[model samples]
Structure formats: C-alpha cells, structure tokens
Target chain A: MIHSDLIRRLPASMKLAAALAVVLLVTAACGGGSSSGGGDTAGAAGLEGKTVNFVGYGKDNPWGAYFNGVFVPKLESQGVKVVDLTTMDPGTAVTNFNQAISNKPDLIVAALLDTSSTVVPIKKAKQAGIPVLVFDGRPDPSVDADVMQVLSDSEALGTAAAQNLVEGLKAQGRNSGNLIAITGTKSGFAAQDRMKGFDAELAKTPEYKVVDIQDGNWDPTLSGKIATQLFAKYGCSGIQGAYGMADYQALPIVAAAKQAGCPVGGKTGLVVTGSNCFKVGIDAIKAGTLYGTATEDPGTIAEQTADYVIRYFNQQNPPAKELVKEERVTAENVAQFAEQCSKA
Target chain B: MNVMSAPPRSDAPIRRPGRSRSRAELVIDAVLLLAVLAAIVLALTTHRFATVANAKAILTSASLVGIAALGLTLITIGGSAVSLAISPSVAAVGMIFLSAQSFGLVPALALAVLCGILITGVQGAIVGYAAANPVVLTIAASFAITGIATGVSGGSTVSPTGGGYDRLNATPGGVALSVYVLIGLALIVQWTLRRTGFGRSLYLIGENRRAARAAGLPVGRTTAVAWLAAGALFAVTAAFTAAFNTSANVNLGGTLTFDAIAAVLAGGTPIAGGRGSALRTLAGAVLIAAASDILLLRGSSTGVQILVKGVIVLVVVVLVHLRTEGSRA
Candidate 1:
C-alpha cells in the first residue's frame, strides 16, 4: 500500500520512470533465477550468439557418428555456432585442439584420442580463462583444466559383458567350460578397462577358464581372422563360449565359427556375447546368432554431454565427472533397446 | 644414331645376366624350404597345428593378402616400386561395393572394380607418363582416396541392404572360395607374365628402361598396365573383405598395405624389379600366415608376432642384398 501511494504522489513523468525501473529489475531477477535453476530451455538464451569449438576423434566410426550427429545439432539449435576440428588421427587431433585453443571461442569442447598428448594444450586453454568440456574420455583427475567430463562406464560395461556371458553359458546348460576373449587393442584404455572388469567378474566363476585372449585391435577383419585361428586352436568342442569387446567383433566371430563348422547360439552350441550395443549386435541378437551384448550407447552419453554443456553455460554447475550407467542386453530384454541400438 | 639400330639386342630375349636370376631363384627356393621345414616342426610340436581346420584357417587368412600381393608382384616386376595406396584403395572400393549393392551383386562388384581401376588408373597415368615417383605418388593418392571416401560416406560404416551376396563367403569342398580365387588369379597372372608380349616388355623395361626405350618398347604403357592389374586385384580383395564383414568403413583393411608389401618382399621379389612371380607371393603369404597362426597357437602376443615378421623381413632383405652383391662381384 505504501509503495502504491508513493508512486501516486509523484509527478506523472517521475511515476512512469519509477514503474519502468521496477519492471526491468523484475525481469533481470527472473532470468537469472531461471538460468541458475537449470531449466532445460531457460538457459539456452545465454548461449545465443556464442561460439563453440569442437575437437573430436573417430568421425568415421559408429560411436563418433552418433555423438556428432546429436550433439552438434543440439548446440546449433540454440544459436551456438560450432567450429568442427574432428580428425581420426591422434597426432592431427592434438594439432586441431591447439588450433581450437588459438581460436579462443566462447567455449572449447573436445573428445581427445589420447589424454596424455593434450594435457599441455588443455592447460593453456585454462590459463586463457576459456572453459573446457570433455567427453568420451576423462582427463586425469589431477588436471584442473576440464570444467566437467561425461564418459561411458567402460569398466561397468565390461562387467556387464561378463555377466551376460555367464548367463548365456547357463542358458546353454553349461556351468563350466573354456572361453576366449577377443578384445580391442591391448594398449587402449577402453580395452584395458573392459578386460580388467571382465577378469574381475569372471574370477568369481572359476570353472570357466579364459583359454586365450587375443587382441583384435577393434578391427572387424582382424577379429574375424583371430576368431578363425582361435577356433582352429581350440577345436569346435574345446571352447564353449566367447566374449567380444564390441558387437561388430562378435558378429565376425559368429561368421568365422559357422565357416569352421562350429555350431553357435543354440542351447547345445557355443555361447557368444558382445559389448557396445551396436545395431549389428542388436540384429544378431534378434537373429539368435549373438547370445547377448552390453549397452555403451554413444547416443545416450552424447545427450548427457549436451545437457552438461547447457548446464555449464547456465551457471548451474554440473558435476565435475559423470559416468553414464550401462546395462546388458540379451534375448529377453533386447526388444527394449532395439530402437536406440539401431540408431547407434 | 638410329634408335632402333642402337639396341637390336633388346629384342633378343630380355635377360639379367642369367646368374643373378638363378641365384635369386635359388635363394627363394631355400627360403621356401626353410618355411616348409619350420611348418613341419610346428606341426610336430604344436598340439592342433596339423589339423585340416588349422590348415584352412591359415589359407583363408593368407588368401586376402595373397590376392593383393599377387597384383603387387606385377607392379614390383614392372619397376614401379611398391604402392602405399593399396589399403586405402581397398577400403574405398569396399565402401563403393556396399553403397552400390542395391543394384544386384554383380553390378555392384563391377562398379567397384571400375572405380578401383579409375582410382589407380590416374595414378598409373601420372607415374607412367610423367615418370613420377611411385612411392610418393601412391602416398599422395592414398591421402586423396581416404579423404574422398570419408567425405562421400560421411565417415560412417556402410552396410548392404540385401543378403544375396553372402554366398560369396561360402566354403566349397572344404576350401574357402577366397583360396580358390587366389589360386586361380595367381595361375592366370603367372601364365600371363610368362607368355604375353606385354609380359616380356615389362621385364625388359624394368631391367633397363633406357635400352627398352631406345628399342621402341612401350615402357610407359606396360608400367600403367601393371598398375591397372594391381587395382583390379585390390578390388577383388575388397569385395571378399566387405562380403565377409557385411559392412564397409574407411578403416577397412587398415593394415593391408603393409601386409601386402611384406608378402611381396618375403616372396623374394627384388625391389629393383625385373623378376618375380605371383605364385611366389602366394607362397610367401601362406608362410607368413602359417607363422602367425603358429605363434598365436603357442599363446604369443601380437607384439611378438610383429617382431617375428619384422625379423623375417630383415633377414630376407639382408639375404637378397648379399646374393645380389655376391652375384655382381
């Protein structure tokens, strides 16, 4: 009541100016609150007209395709102009990242091929007062340059793969048998973590011995070759189950096994499981050639990464590190993930 | 100086002093004998190395590299040095095949081969007519091919819409179709190298380009034909690889160039050219494959396999160098 009376007593011009000032103050308060509250579309206004530089890797592979397909469009839809510096080569990726830092965009988003190679440039970006958002690979915990990171639970995915393998074996009416692990390049962090998790989980089941572990190098052709050699070395009856680090790798094993005259996928046949929930794996699962697979869907991780980017810009302060959840997909639950996996 | 009269000797059978050729052949034979003895020792020592399944595995794995090496042998013989573009070309052709599969299998395969021909044909024309460095030209071609493939495919894996071509992966009579293809191609290529005028011209041109040019030989054309033949074989390798994987990507056959080169070198083909055979490349591919399989069976790491292959290449290179030096002396 007092505020209204004061306005009424003022001259007409003074009253108009005072009312305008109050309106502007209220608008500012609302916008600030909305941005801080982490409202989905609320903070997008802040990103308008800003530029982001994206340094990525493996633009040719499925995981990279899915992530780039989703993430770039989302940011662009909010009026964020993106500069793409994606490359498949590790050395080239570092050069691109440094170039991105020099561009000094409003933000720097990167998915480095190797963290060790980019630590120096990331520090430079930090010193420049530019925020960095990392995805696909987590930076070293000691590094303070990265504002936040969104990564797949690769170790958990590996554990899920082991669980699926065991379940597939049980479903095939076997409690004890020999198994082979066809993994990606042994030096890769993802491959190593997956194997570590696989070993930790498989240790609980002592009867199932890992007779051999060969590096497939994440190559389908090499994996197929390794599968053939493994089949020859182990014989059709000697091994009962197999684990492929990815669905593409697992599918080749299925083909190789068929060529080797080894029965696969039936109750009495060999049990095969893969990870990475690729469409090929989903299709094979539907076709009954693949026993099971674990979900490390690139699309899901990408979406979360996008959300974190939005949150960061809005000053909502997303967590320093986020590990996306992973699950195992088998015949029983394959239908639920079929659509997403197909997209991946 | 009558160009034709300057080298009447060029038309009378292109020979390399006879002794050097025979010594090289003898060294190749010794290498083959050593490979055989090693295989026998592995079979006796290893538990499952002697099985038919194991033999099939080795041959099946070797066939891919064997086919590519066979074509590479022609290039090496024609004095073009080695091509570093084989892997990229194979990958590009595989992508082309998968993309064109909607128009029946044979048409897609033909299109793929034509694309491969066009790709290497340009490189051949440059190397043959312009006398460009084969290694540098092929390296540049690899970059261009990889870039184009990535852009055209949008850096995604290409999968066939239909399954009609899966029969290409079939094993007939307990032998892989790829092995049969490799053997058939090797025989045809070997026969052509022995009987054709083009083959004789290649040998003459490779041994002494100046003499062949003075005698009015088609040096440039023969070199180009060698490259074209290699491209066609590379296309065949791509087809089999894509059919086996049921998908094609830019990374397809990533290690193929190195493997193919290794096969050519191990086959006892002199890098200086003028002599070699497709059958030798096949044998070399088989030996390498068998060695890899044996190592794998014995639980060796990939590093060890690579190290052993490096050692084999080093030994073969040194042995060839010694023989050539000895013969010259």
Candidate 2:
C-alpha cells in the first residue's frame, strides 16, 4: 500500500511541475518588455521594401485629411510606404478592408468605428497570413489574440471633463445647482464610457445636481436642438453647467445657449467641456465658448499605427497592446494645440 | 353597378377576437393619441423630461421627421404606401440647396423643393409605367440616389460655410416654423384627400383595385401624382434637416424611413391599402418621438430604446394585420 501511494504521488507531482513550468515560461516571456523582438532585427533590417496598407473611417473628414496629409508624410519620411483604402460608411469600409486583405499585404492598419462591424474583416485578415493592427476602437474578446489594438483610457477623458466642470463651478462659487449632460449616440461605446466616467466623477461631489442626460447622436443640430430647449426651460438659473461628449456636440450647445442669450464662455458662461479634439472644439475653448476639451491626437494615432505596422514588418517583437494618452485642452493651452492642428 | 360585386368568400371566419377594429380603423389616430399621452407622461415623470427645454428639443428633432412623415402619409393614402425613393431623393436635392446657399435662404429652399419634386416625379413615372413591385423599385431608387449623393458630396458632410442658410436654420423660432410647416402640409394633404374627386378615386382604387379599374380610374396617373407630392414633401424635410444640422451627409435621411414607416403603421394605416388620414399620421409621428424621448430621459441605452421600439412595432403590426383581416372576414 505504501509503494502504491508513492507511485500515485510521483505522477501528480510531475504534472504540477510541468504546468508550473509552462506558466513560469509565459510569465517570463510577457514580463520581459523589449518590443524590439529581443534584438531580433538582424534579418528584419532588410525589410525596407515592404508596404503596409491602412483602412479607416472618416476618410473625408478633417481627421482623415490630417492623417493622410500630415501623418502619412511623417511615416514616409522613415521609408515606409502607406496605402489607404478608407471611407466613412462603416459597412462599406469594412468590406473594402476585407477585399484589401485578400490581396495579402505585408500588414494592415484599421480604425473601426464600431468593433462589431470589423470582426469579420479582422478575422479574415489574420487568417490570411496578414498582421492587422487596430487603433482607436475596441476589439471583441474572442478575436483579441488575433490582432493587436491601441486604445486610450477614455474613462479618464470623462473624469477630466467632470473635474474641469467642477472647478469651473467652484470658481463661480456654486454650492448647489443642476448640471445637464449631452451625450453622443447613446449606443456608442465611447459615448457610454465617457458619460459614465463623467457621471462617476460628478457623483463624488454631493452639491452638484445632475438633472438630465440626452443623446444628441453626435450631430451638431441635435445637440443644438437639445440645448436650445434646455436653455429656454432652465434659463441661466438652476443649471450651473453642461457636459458634451465631443466638440461637434459642444458647438451646438454653445450656439443654442448663445441664441437663447444665455451667458457663455469664461466663468460666467455655461461651463461646457467634452472629449474628441476637433478643431471647432479647440477654437471654442480659445473663444471662451467651451471650458475644457480632451485631445486624442488623431494624427498621432495615425502616425503611431504607421510605426506599429513598420515594427511588424521589421519582425520586431510587437507589444501586446498600446494605450495612448489624452490631455485636457483648456483655454490655457488651446492656442498652442490649435496652432499645431491648423498647421496639420 | 350590380355587376361590380364584392368577391365571394370561401368559408372564412365571420369574426375573430382582436379583429373588426373599426374603433381604431385609422391606425394614425390611435398612434397620435398614444404619442401625446407618452409625451405628457414622460415629461411628467422623468426629471426635466417635460421641461420647456425638452419640448423645444423634441420639436426641433421632430421637424424634419414630421415633414417626411407627412409625405409618406400622402403616398399611403394614395392607394399605395410607397415612397418611390423619396427619402434619399430629397437628401440629394437638399445638397444642391446647401451648396447654393450663398444666394439667399428663400431661393435656396425653393430650388431644393423644385429639385426634390423633379426627382420624385421621374421616379413616379417610371414606377407607375413599369407597374413594378414598390419594394424592389424603391430599393433600387434609394441605392441610385445614395450613390449620387455620395458622388456629389464626396462621401462627406457639406456644411453651409456661411450665408442665409445659417440664418434660416438658426432663426430663434426654428421649432415653431417647422411645426407650422407640418400643419400646413397636413391641411393641404387633407384637402386633397377629401375635397378632390381624384382623392375619392384613390380610396376607391385602394379599397378595390379591380372594381376601380372597371370604373375607369386613372390608377397610374394617380400614383404618379402621389409620388410627386411625396417627393416634394421629402425635399422640404431634407432641406430642413440639412439646414438644422448645418451639414449634409450620405446618411441624411437614413433614420427617417424607419420612423416614417413606424408612424404610419402606428397611426393605423392598413398596409393592405386604402385607409388612413394625415391627422392620424401626425399623431403617430408625435407618438414615436415622444416614446423615444421618454426612453432617452429615462437614461436608457440606445440598444434598449431600439429594442423597445422594435417590439412595439412588431406588436402593432400584428394587431393591424389581425384587424384588417377581421374587418374583411
């Protein structure tokens, strides 16, 4: 009986050791953080002739123009050729990416507005022996291992906006009042996260009363419409400030408030702030229309994505993920960033 | 006259529960009433739901949607509930107005209406003459129009950089103006349906097509005219939407189709044909807006809101179907 017990324990101990060794090896591999593929560039240095194609949304918007015009130039200065197959229509653009992958480019970079729509294309790209790098959008968990993604701590964008609003209120010496939040399309991930972030931060302060939240569908007209009525109903009383999801949204809120003859800009105006660094929002900040706005640097994201594609091409160890930082652009620094953006 | 008799029935059930809905034969009326109730309830219960601000917002958002619903009402009552690609047609036409806003607001708006009328008339003529399936025909027309809009705008939103266009959209009483436009459209459509002989012919053809054919009704001409009217209405709505949004994109009228269709169905327009009123559709549109607004105020997610709407639409459609069949049986 003793001999049999020893035999059973020996096999169990060996199995446990083997599992522990596998986990330890993975931990070591992941913990060792040199994205240069552990200096494996000896053979990859000759990858100068490779081409990486990129497809994204908002192809004709100002964001796209900067990415294509300025960021592409930055990457090309490093000897990487970038091909664009981009469009604004979510469905159509995803299809374009699917077709682009069939040709098997060296690498592909895509920014899917909605993660759900891009799954098929991303999966197909990965399966077809092409490495796909996604930026500015979340990825589905099932498909996460297939492609690498770059994201921002957007929740922080929300908290920062809320903090700015709180400070503005404090500057006005507000102990109690209503604050309305105007959100982008209610279903969008960014809209929900940003709203939650702002809401969570605002909750920390007891005196500020959050009255209502409405979805503006990220349309200026809709935001203006919502703001117009909110101003007329509440006037400059009760409501101390407002939070908008994006600059596009902030423009309308400002317009509606201005139309209603409500005090705006500076400390006296409705304290408005948002995420997404559109030129209009930065201008709004400088003009004292918006209190604060978050900047993601789309051009930087584009440039970084370009760099990532280059890394994959060079067979350098790719980082599992990358997170870009967003800074709150207020009246203090709106001019500086605005100048750079305008130049782009 | 005796020879033009109702078709013989083959042992159909005389009546069914939830059938014979004469009280709500007009779906639009019920939809309208429901919408009004929803708005009142939403505004009352939800914080800041019924505030003047929300009302203004609702009206502003509803302006173009309300106008588009009016056009759809005309088409539905014209004996065929079809748009002939009215949505995208108007969106494309409105771009021209937006592009030419430097001239003046009145002229820009007028040109947009004209463009819309022409596009719809052409479509009406083709669909009328071909006698094609409205679904397939309108789908093709939509695709073509969307392509054109994309080509014209280069798949981007084109804002009125500066001009009367901005002034018109930003006019302080923009909401009121939109409401007045909707009222005027309703009155005009009501007058056409009730006062004109062509209107009676429309109902006649819708109720009994073969009988109307025997009575020598100009069915094709009526459909063409109705479609043209819809096109014109859609054009105005598109212009308003573009002006209000301060931009025009390829998906300008994308959301209107579902809204318009929902309003029409909820208002009690029988899909089988020939029984609805402008009043009913107006109410339906309001109700749809009110429902969405209520959900929005409740802080519901977009997905949940859409799901609720889908369920409501499904239930209403089933009821409408049952009522239609029960009335006949």
Candidate 3:
C-alpha cells in the first residue's frame, strides 16, 4: 500500500522513467544470461541490426514451428531482424522465396518442402546478393547458391531405423524374415533419401527381405490402412518387421497390426521402427508397442540451424554442409530421449 | 385466339410431383452391384483378399471417409454443392477435441462437435441467408479455419492425455467401433432424409429452388439445417479419427474433402442435388475402400491406386450424367 501511494505521488514523467530503467535492466540481464547460455553468440558482431528473410513452411508445420519458435527467436535475440515469409503450401513457399529474394535481405534462411522446385529461386536469391542458409531439405548438389545447408541426415535416420528394426527382430529370435516399409510421399526428397538409406542398410542383412514399400504420404490414416492391408496380405506369421517413416505413421501401423492380430514390439510378434523422434514414438517405446524410432527431431535441428546462422554471421566459416547428428531410441534408451522427443 | 376459353372439367384428383426411380438411379444401382460382384470375384480368386481380417480393414479404413461423406451428402442434397471447408473443419474439430480432452471425454467430444457445427454453420448461414456462393464462401472459410487452427496449434500435433476415447478405436468381434459408428450414422441419416419434413424440404429446394420458393418452402432454413447436420457428422469423423490415431494435428483430415466429394459423386448423387440416399453413399464409400485395398494388396503404387480411383469416379460421373440427361430428354 505504501509503495503504491509513493508511486501515485510521483509525477507521470518520473513513472515513465522508472519503467524505462526497469526495462533496460531486464534487457541487460537477459542479454548477459543468454550470452553465457546455449545461445553463446547472442549480440555477436555483424548479427546485430542485420536483416534476415526466413522462407519456409508455415508455423503450423512441426518443423516450421521449430524454425519459428526456436530458430527465429534465437536469431532475433542476437538483434537480427527476421522477416517471416513462411507458408503451408509448397506453391506458396516458392512464391515466398521469390518474394524474399526480391526483398534482398542481408541473409535468407529457407527450408523448402519441395526440393525439386527450389533450385531456381535459390539461384535467384544468390543473384540478388542474398546469402542463403538452407535447412531441413537438400537441394541439388549442383546448386551452390547456399552458403551452408543444415540437414537432419534423412538417410541416417532411415539407416538407424533399419538397424533398430533388425536389432528388434534379432531380439525376437528371428534371423531372416519379410519386412515392409511405409514411407512418406514418394516424391519427397526426405522420403526418397530415407528409403535409399534404409534399403542400403538392409542389404547388409539380405536374409531379411523387404516384401513391400508403400507410400503412406506421412498420413496416419493412410499408413494405418496400408499396414492393415499389408498384414492381411502377408498374414500374421509372414512378416516379421516393418518401418514407418514417422512416429505418427508408426503408431497407426502398430494399431493396425494389432487389429490384424499381428501385435508388434516386445520379444515376440512383428518388430516395428519409425523415424522423426515424436512423443508418440517415445510413448510407444515405453509401452513396448513400438520397437524404436530414429531422431529426426525438429527441435534439435532448429537449434543447430540457429547456431549455424550465428556462426555464418560471425564469419566463423561454417562448413558448406552440416548434418545434424541423429540417434536411435529404443526401449533401452527411450527414457533418456523422451523429454527431448516430447518437446518436439 | 381463345386462350381464356374454359373447357368442361372432370373431377379427378390432381397428383403432386413426387420422386420416382429414374434412369440415373438405375445406373447407380447397376454400378454398385457390379462393384460388389467384382469384389466377390476378387475375394474368391485371391486368398488374402477374402480373409475376415481384410474385410475389417476395408471397413475400418472406410469409416472416417464414409462419415465425412455422409455430411457432404447432406450439403450436396441441400443444393449448396460441396463445402471445400470440410477437411479444415475436420482438422479443426480434431484439434479442438484433443485440446479439450483435459476436460474429460464426453465434454471434449461435445465441445469439438459444437465447434465443428459453429464453423460450418456460420458458413452455411452466409451461403443461405446472404445468398453467397457456397464454393467461394467455403474456400474462404477453409483458409480462415486453417489459419486459426495453425495459429492456435503452432503447427504442433495435439496428443490426447486421457483414456476412454480409445474405445472408439477398439475392434470388437473383429469389427472396428468406427465401422459400427459409420453404419449407425448412415442408418440415422438415411431415415432422416426419407421420413422427415426437413429432409423433404431439402429435396424440394435442391430439386427446384425457384419452385420451392414459389411454394413458400423454407429454403434457407433447410440449407442451414443440412449444413449444421453435416458439421455434426464431420465432428464425429474428427473425433473417431483422433481417437483412432491417438493424436490430432492441423493435418488431421488430409485429402478428406476431396475423398468425401468423390464418394458423394460416386454414390450416383447428382451434383445438381435433390436426388440421393445415404445408403448409396455408404455403398460408394465401401466400394472405393475395397478397390483401394485390393490395389494395395496387389502391390500397386499410390499413383496407380489414385489413377484407378479417378477412373472409377469419372466413369460413374459420366454414366450418371448421361443417364440423367437421357431421362430428361
């Protein structure tokens, strides 16, 4: 009551001054704290007052959420001005890229969903004198428009999923059997790369044959339906393992398999694995309904991408290509990664 | 020359214009029968395709699309054409359901369905009362709903924290709860359309809007009711979908709008409206589901399956159109 009365007695200008001082103090404290934290490059030279155009998926997409929620804020905290040109539609994303290039910000950060359509806009951005930092997608190798590309290593995710599935199968006392792969959109770069890696890794253990590779389009319903049909076609005993490209897809596959009387996971039944470390996969691992999942975590990818951006601005000479490290999470290690996966 | 001249009249009961089985209806029936026959033949030939497990799979897969189609059927019947907003509405409701799950199952579901009704119902009002173009209005609504849902969710998946709703995903006696729900809803919707005054008004308005207006029928009210009912069905679809997946996201109802529209057209419902049955839509949904499953089981690619579905829809549409046109002539 006394403090309120004293403030009421003060003039409006004095109150305004006090508020400004408090804000400055808070800002300084945050800046000091952030510089010593994970965002060590906060307020780094060259980044302050710089402008960056971020063209990627809309905030509704999980990866887009990470970019907007984590990457943009991290960069902004360092005094970088970010212009959001994100979109949910692939077509709109292309348009946004062109718009961003026209704007000619000091730097451009893009994560195009359709890699095939990105090369031209990337070149256009380069011609506009904008240094592009790409993430989440890998454009053609010949397209050297980007200063650096930070990717989740989709192939490694696939490889890890394959390894986990194999390990699960072996643990179930099976050396060789039929496996099925339910992939995302067939034309997507990530899906194609993941499949390539998966196939390559599975080749080492030729005894386990991939009976089918169906496109689930990263849709849970479609994936579940595909699983149901595959299980029926192969029966409960014919197929011993499966791979769903995402945890959402993987969870449905488990349900469909169970419905088909071919329960997955544990020491028996079909072994299932997925990528994209989502909370669903972690929970499934905990419940022993899913064998494992590989880390294609959006949160980690976003953080690493933000770090690369800071480095690029600091002239630290980041490599042309940076692959975010990924790991497999099974029942043995799911607990360790559950919190991170859940956050994603 | 003598246009006003009156002739001697005989007392005979004047018959009202009523729905009679048309050539288009016949074509739809024939197509459905052929599809069933083809399914049976494939089942006989392919050991894997004939299993009880595959049947359950087909029905379970069809359930969500079937439910959504039932709602779209009402809109189509009420002469509003199709709502491009169905998928977004479904996604929004699913998100709402998951978001409200902390309130417990019944309330969450009720709230979710209510949200669906409000979303589509408002659009319906615009289209009905304001005489807005449904296609354009629904397209705009789709964008708005998607934007709102995305903003609210921040593009994150909404996972359910509670139980009980998982019962909707259960398969009792090898039949999914979703499948049963679809059947039950189908029966109710069919009865409603056939036996209710609102249903008759929809047919009347859809059949001839000018004539219905001239006859003092409640055209706007019927259209709104159709949309409201459809919204409820869509909510049910979202609920079952979220329950089955154990999660929901802004992408919850991927390809649903197109699929439901396709199902409605495939069911032999005239795009011009006024003529169709929920049972026909059910048959169409089942046929499409079975065909897709058969294609998948045969190792066909997604492209091939989509191509096949396109062919089926096109063939049905062309046949029905031709038959309807011929009958009109």
For candidate 1, give the lDDT of residue A99.
Answer: 77
Best by TM-score: 3
Clashing pairs in 3: A60-B155
Question: Candidate 2 lDDT, tens digit per residue, A179-263?
Answer: 8888877777777778778889989996887887877787555566567656655667756788877766776676666555567
For model 1 chain B, give the 10-residue run with minimal summed lDDT. Answer: B4-13
Instruction: Give the TM-score (vs. native) of candidate 1.
Output: 0.87
Q: How much RMSD separates candidate 3 from the native structure? A: 12.4
Cα-lDDT of candidate 1: 0.81
**Docking quality (DockQ) for each candidate:** 0.38, 0.14, 0.38
lDDT of model 3 at residue B253?
A: 86
| Docking level of model 2 | incorrect
Clashing pairs in 1: none
Q: What 10-residue stretch in candidate 2 chain B is worst by lDDT? A: B3-12
Q: Model 2, clash count? A: 12
Residue ranges of candidate 1 with Cα displaced over 4 Å: A1-45, A140-147, B1-43
Point out the higher-scoring one by TM-score: 2 or 3. 3
